[model samples]
Target: MMLANVGTADRIIRIIIGLAIIAWSISAENLWWILGAVVLATGVFKFCGLYKVLGISTQGSTSK
Candidate 1:
């Protein structure tokens, strides 16, 4: 299994923000759903590819 670098709090916030953005984008007929998808993916999976590339992790040691 792959390690999850995203912390619980961060994941929650991401999901909330992603949903909000997606809702707003849909109402405005924009393509921001792509961004929402990325955010949701990272939060759901508890992993962030950009975080890994930048060597940044929010997860605690025990979680890793």
Candidate 2:
């Protein structure tokens, strides 16, 4: 399975960031919700583009 670890801290941070973005969108009427959307998307995919660029995989073995 390619879907591996994605530790607890990262998961929580992603969720918090996404919620914050969405919240900011409502309160500040900014486009920061896109950040939230990205966070949510990353959580769903269990993959981060930045992480890949940095050659990092917290999700255990990326090789399926």
Candidate 3:
């Protein structure tokens, strides 16, 4: 299983951005929704594969 690399703030921002992208994509009839779904998944799961690979973690010591 992947570790939690996304912090609270990052998660919130990702969720909002993901939703916006998804909504816009639907209206525009584009394929950006796929990217939006990935962003949303990372936020909802609190884990980021890229962050892990890049040795980046937004999570604070106080968080789980």
Model 1 misplaced regions, further than 4 Å: none
Ranking by lDDT: 3, 1, 2
TM-score of each: 0.90, 0.71, 0.93
| Positional deviation of residue 59's Cα in model 3 after best superposition, in angstroms | 0.7
lDDT of 2 by residue, 1-64 (tens): 3443455578778878888788989799888888889997777667777877677777664443
Model 3 lDDT-worst window of ten: 55-64
Error of 2 at 20 (Å): 1.5
lDDT of 1 by residue, 1-64 (tens): 6689999999999999888888988999999988998898899999999999899999978822
Better model by TM-score, 1 or 2?
Answer: 1
Q: How many clashing pairs per prediction, in order?
A: 0, 1, 0
Error of 1 at 50 (Å): 0.5
Pick the lDDT winner.
3
Write down the TM-score for model 1.
0.90
Looking at model 1, which ten-residue stretch has the lowest summed lDDT? 55-64
